[model samples]
Target: MNEDKNRIVSHGAFVVRYRAAGAYRFEAHSHPYLTVTSVMSGMLEAEIGSSHLVAAPEESLFTNSFQSHSGNGSDLEFVSVGITAEAVAEAAINAGFTKAGADIAFNNSYSSDRSVAEIARAIAAEVLSEEPGRNAMLDALISQLVIVLLRSHLRVKRSPLIELSRAGPVDRRLRRAMEFMHDNYSRDLGIEEIAQAAYLSEYHFARLFRRVTGVTPHAYLANLRLEQARELLINTGESISDIAGAVGYQSQSHFTKAFKAVTGLTPKSYREGTTRAVEPAEAGKAGLESSNKVSSGE
Candidate 1:
């Protein structure tokens, strides 16, 4: 097996475990691998890009690769199932799934109370168990999990590509601009360069892009950079200055200021917060609250 495959706890394309003590905080980060998270026990507040999601016990969150996000848990134990984007796309094509054109952004709420939760629990248990044919078992479980999630997505009439296409002409153009920004975010991206990618005049593109995405192209790019920096901070022991440079910020102070503005917490504080545990009382309360959130939404 390849080293990347070996790194996985499962036989499928992507899967791993993150077990941390107390309330865990993750700085903004993006992964090349798609991720599906299941909260075994605990409460977590996650920000996927600019949107916020609250995860309770048995709930799941699916994020596409390179989707900027961050999370923090107070008194919780969780397991995240990582699937490669290539694997998901291949599976969809093989299954002949069509785009549904709805934005199926990940919700903190459970998709289905009985069935989806049951499947999540079963997969979690099997993954944690040491038994015969564990690899095969994991592969089967991942397949089942993907099916359940696809069903949930279909029920909501949401397909990623379809949703992207539905963003209207202006939004589509903005998405293209975002693509360009992502590709060259570490380098100096002139407004004219981004505008050309979307086939619009710089003034027109700048106005429309902000109208659609709620931030100037520069601000949006900065947000993406900070998100990348946050990920390195949490996942690696890289020094702050190195991370700053990697994400295109020459001044550590500038990066720190932007990171705090977007995340509401300084990077150092966020990292330290991850080391503290969530109080038992608060965990119980969050569990109850999440249950209510799911049922009420239905």
Candidate 2:
């Protein structure tokens, strides 16, 4: 959305996202790249396949490429590094798993390695500063994360012997309802309309949806909207008022209140914290200035 090239830092083979604080949920989804999320504070509740995981501070979670996983955070600060599959393969080869590159995966979703946690924080620091060599620092950090995973946690990819199922008409209805919520989260959505999408009455829909998701439809939609707003704040130069409207909130004040309640930071503060970066020429100039100071022995 934000066409400003400065807002985005290009890491050649990885994508990095950071959240300073928030309650957020990602509905069931899969990606072609592997993801490692390190939680620096609070907790992350997630579901990977049939496994439910809770990662607290100093813990990291791994999701292999194409693994269907979903997670929600509770007042957390985290950095998630998304590594391209090709990068993983190359890393695996360099780790002496040359024949196993195609088979590399994580059998488990949870890790408590301190190196992973520290590297995650380093990546976050690099993201927030305009320090010289920021891009190079990020690339090296990403490579460190990958190396840690390959050395300490790599597993062979394999097919499950049996499939787990939640199959039934009710499950189908609930999924349809979730799909509707996801598709139209940018607009004001109501219970009645959402119920119709699931082919259920409003009363039953409210009850069943909560039972299935452990959260009400309204809560789910709000989380989805706030997550979108968070991304806009981090990656775009849009005003807070504009972001509120884009995420379906009619009032800027209301959006600010809700955002602070969940994230522990105002929208403006969050944006300011996440978008700091130095242009190459400016960084070079700053380095030169520092060198001049050192030469003068001041």
RMSD of each: 12.3, 11.5
Clashing pairs in 1: 14-82, 22-277, 23-277, 75-278
Which stretches in model 1 have alpha-carbon errors above 4 Å? 1-17, 26-35, 46-54, 61-72, 82-86, 99-115, 118-140, 154-176, 190-192, 202-243, 251-298
lDDT of 1 by residue, 81-116 (tens): 666544554555556563424433334423334465
Model 1 clashing-pair count: 4
Q: TM per model?
A: 0.55, 0.53
| Worst window of 10 by summed lDDT in candidate 1 | 289-298
Error of 2 at 99 (Å): 3.8
Q: Rate the local accuracy (lDDT) of all candidates.
A: 0.57, 0.67
What are the clashing pairs of model 2?
Answer: none
